[model samples]
Target: MVQYPFCALLMLSLLIFLATIPNAFFTQACLTTGYLRADAYQTRCPGVEAIVFAGVEQAVADDPRMAASLLRLHFHDCFVNGCDASVLLDDTLTFEGEKTAAPNLNSLRGFEVIDAIKSELEFACPETVSCADILAIAARDSVVLSGGPTWQVLMGRRDSLFANKGLANKNIPAPNSDVATLVSKFQNVGLSQKDMVALSGGHTIGKARCSTFSTRLKGSSSSDSPGLDKDFLASLQQLCSEFDNNNMTLAELDFVTPATFDNQYYTNLLSGEGLLASDQALVAEDGIATRNLVETYAEDPQAFFEDFKTSMVKMGSLKPLTGKSGQIRHNCRIMN
Candidate 1:
């Protein structure tokens, strides 16, 4: 009896000791095959996250819109070619890139901001940082600056040698996508429907071009779009009519608080004020689960933030070129 109790006490003490170890160490050990580690640069390039965060901070301070642009950049890059920074490449003769894709061309911005961040990192740590990782970190910093939840963005992603313009056009979720299409697009990228709704909360801080949502305006189509608020549609019609270029005219996705990253986006959808057809579909369409998620997020800001952070991490980790599979680009716009 004495020996049995002594052995049990020893085992309990050993278990407590093991539990004290940093969870990341065991996590990295198991996930090292094709995944990244949060502290990947801690040894190789210390202060990397700080450098990227400071760069993003100054940029966002100068232009608050840059935060949304950077966040969207990471999403687009991850969706197309597995967060490989292929979206950052510039087109050249005999070389086509995602920059001109239907989902990107004239729509995506903030490349200059990324270029500036890359330059600082190269100066401080040389080629130790990959452009793909920069996009990931910059995205996290953007969310934090926009008053959203922040998660540890896993690093160690490498830039792809080739761009996927075709995938970029086909893979990205469209503004007019219904709840079903949105669910399908996200699922294609290894994310669940819960992630789709949470990630859509990103629209809280971005603006949509008139061309992206103009068709939903009242009388602009044969039937007034279902679930679209009448007053919101009239206002959008007036705002869009003022511009000679549909692409030039922009509308805030979250009508109440456009620049902040918060649950107001879900609230907007609940009130039939979502600027995009896809956004409203979350609440109005036949997606009962998505509608429940929208209601939950609208009722709880913390839940929305938590889900958004989780989804962002999962999205950033999708199909990344880890280990020796890809090369780190000296210039984000071109291969080293």
Candidate 2:
């Protein structure tokens, strides 16, 4: 009877040990593929997104020439999936909206930085890291360089092999899109109108090209222009005039949250101080959807983070390659 008890105890111990292996393995795998590491801070909060922003920010700080490519990586990663690193490619396949070059200078600058960062990292880490991961790293670098907060990011996303230029144009919300049109665009991507309003908060930091916001500055369409606040309209008109002669002063979309990733963007909308008509459109019409989302995001940054995360996941999934069609890119600029 004592022998039997000993055997039973050994068997139970073995079972417990076996069960813990997977968890241990999971933690180990996550150590490399997960967690954000930058400066003195190391965490996994914002996951891949934070790494990408920080990486690019750092790259730019090291070499201003890398800013454009890093910015491109940032935009692509954010649009496809909340910075999941799907835009990176291995030998397998590519994701949708993966074009050879950015359609415009703004995009071109961003993509160039991405290319430079990829090259620099490949020299340091070799094949151990993927382009997608580089994107996360670069994003962090970019933000920090621009004097923005460094967010936490998770990792472990696979790379894509293909690029879809057509889809890129179709999906990315244009600066001129009206509120309803913006709502539909977000809806098609599994986001709600409220989500659209919330994501627009990103405009807080980025500068809009003269062409993107020129319509607002021109007061082109009276129907839309009338909706803008009178004093704001005059300011926009003057700014547009200046931009017409000088492309450099293309005007900021959100003067308040221009750099910080906070709720001040929504507060601007509530006060009739929004920079873009599309932004103001959120509050100009309709029921509580706009106000509710703005208030929610304004009051609870965590809620905004949650919704933003969900929306980013949906955005990333816009048109991914599964079951093999594209290849993981060795070079994000050119196909492998």
Candidate 3:
């Protein structure tokens, strides 16, 4: 009789102990098994999507170029550290951030807009949301507000505690890359050649510094190689010569439609009017598959929109830290 009572007491104690465990522990465990989803924040942070879009829309209204800047911010963040928002970190005494990397130093913008969105979110939900998710959402909203294709962005990505300046410099494809090099870079990041061509169409709404494309305007080294249009090259030279400083002069990447996200980027490429060497390389002789993709997108805006939507989702899915792996950062620029 005594042994039976002791066994019953032990079992009851174990049940009580298990019941005391926090629900978050189990929720975190479940999140480890799958990729993030569009509704990840539906319960934890209601109305988050609206808050992000409103902030992005207001910023774009103030400066139309902000749409492109935010989109580039997402791309740069993902390529370096897998959509972790490490690019948003500011340089501190103990930590060096991605802002000073070779490719991003003066090129990347829109941090203030991100900060504004985060402030609004913090007021509404406190520590319930992550900065990485905010960036992903802001990028999508930027595209939609700029007349680009809209897609559902996955959430629940946690902010990274560390930033990689070296990887940012190394992984970002250079403006002067050849077709093969561009293809290789995309492949290394698990993006297909078609994805590369489609994503490059983002150039439809952005501007590039003169220093990024001035070499191509100097004339081709080989006569057999195709070059930009003579008149287009002259126009570029004139626009880029306004300031003695090479980096200060800016030219629209898609001259036909600089503010709209459309197939005009591919159309411009077809006409030998691509602003950057990497842009032209997609249609170069060696870029058989990429050239085909460029022509297809130019001829069919619907196809480009569909494929770009898929590619953006695919890019955002790269190596996210979910579950109990990383923290939901209160401040995007600092580690908690």
Candidate 4:
């Protein structure tokens, strides 16, 4: 037996401790601090999800389109800076807010809806609930209210003190994105290509501005977009021409059952009715992986629902402020 010195034993113990740590802490770091759990507010703010659902139900009752808008808020917020509610901040003289970002300006509705929900939450639980968690819960409720899948949303996220307007513009996948671009955008936020395809299903219930897919219409190029259906192309052209390319003029992302959250979006992509260039690219221009996913989801609604819920829960886990790292803002629009 060999005898080891006290310093050698100490060094060996230190190395063993370091080896026990997760490789992700060194290789792929969580951009934000903290851990979130499904039962984060079980005691502090019990039935918080139900309260948020009530608010979302009322909002969706007022306008069915709001379901899509609220869902988009969670996507936009998570893509920029983890799951922090930085996207909720309004611009101030001292600092810029994500609301004015290129990807968000004039679009990204449902702010007033969030404010209304926040008001109710403040009355019920005071500052115990974070605005970030509200966005997540509201997103899930919005989907369920629209006849989509329901998932367990992990809570305990805290509101961001500042917004990243530049990241908002650069990070959110643009409507004109191709399959490769979409994959890259999602990957930048630590999401997989499968997650990207599934999350894009959220478009099943939303509307897009005419400007988003105007180029896919006739005459923008000598030839129509690849895999663009001829009849769908003609209708879109008429719609755009009628609006004179007005950005305010809108078209449903999934025209068939537009307000319903269903697998019809994938079915549309399979038949080439996908509205945005980024949307159709999944099945049209893309090969193998994404196209296969598009096919799988189109044929199996249950598969789509399961994958979508998994993706939503995964996306919600992005960099969150946990363990008292951030404050629970009294007003979602401003830091507390």
Candidate lDDT values, in order: 0.89, 0.55, 0.87, 0.87
lDDT per residue, candidate 3, 22-41, as tens digits? 76655444456555887776
Q: Please state every model's RMSD to the true fold in angstroms.
A: 4.8, 6.1, 5.3, 6.5
lDDT for each residue of candidate 4 in 247-278, tens digit (9 for 90 to 100) = 66889999999999999999998887889989
Q: Candidate 4: where are CA atoms >4 Å away?
A: 1-33, 218-222
Tell me, by lDDT, which candidate is best.
1
- Residue-level lDDT of model 1, residues 195-291, one tens digit each, is 9999999999988899897668647532478887777788888898887884579888887988899999999888878888999999865989999
lDDT of 2: 0.55
TM-scores for every candidate against the unseen true structure:
0.89, 0.68, 0.89, 0.88
Model 1 misplaced regions, further than 4 Å: 1-33, 218-223
| Model 3: residue 67 alpha-carbon error in angstroms | 0.1
